[model samples]
Target: MATVEVDQDLCVGDQICASMEPEIYEMRDDGLAYVVDGMEEIDDDDLIAAAKDAADACPVDAIIVEE
Candidate 1:
């Protein structure tokens, strides 16, 4: 399984993660990116790929994926 996390302090609210993976990422009211509830840890291959893609797409590299 992979753990997905977003560093709110570093997030610039670009929404790239949310745009790439809406099911796992979202733009919160604070104007930062965050992993959706219940999606912090991912076991599915497709979801993992999506999460990784989102992490890579983050301009500020605020997204972290731990396997």
Candidate 2:
């Protein structure tokens, strides 16, 4: 399984991760991006790929995706 997380301390509210991978990431009211509820652990290959893409797209490198 692949796991994804956004480091709140490193998040810059850029929204790139959320935009690139809405299924795994979301922008909260605080303007920071977070991993959507129940989506931290991913089993689908497509979702895992998207998470990796989002991580690479994050300007602050706040998104962490691990297999």
Candidate 3:
């Protein structure tokens, strides 16, 4: 499984990660991007790739993906 995280402290509410990977990242009511619950461990390769892409697209580099 792949491990994913979003550091809210560094998040700028860009929503890039959410737009890029809705299944892995979401824009919370607080305006910061967050890793979807139960998504800390992703088993699908497509989802993992999406998570990595989202991490790369984050303007503030708030998303983290470790596979």
TM-score of each: 0.96, 0.96, 0.92
Write model 1 residue lDDT over 1-67, tens digit each, in one string.
9999999999999888998899999998999888999999999999999999888888888999999
RMSD of 3: 0.8
Candidate 3 per-residue lDDT over residues 1-67, each given as its tens digit: 8899999999999888888778778888999988889999999999988888888787888878887
Per residue, candidate 2 scores C-alpha lDDT tens digits across 1-67 of 9988899999999899888778789999999999999999999998999899999999888888999
Give me the candidate number with maximum lDDT.
1
RMSD for each of the candidates: 0.6, 0.6, 0.8
Stretches of candidate 3 off by over 4 Å are none
lDDT of 1 at 40: 95
Which portions of model 1 miss their true places by more than 4 Å? none
The list of candidate 2 runs beyond 4 A from truth reads: none
Q: lDDT per model, in order? A: 0.92, 0.92, 0.87
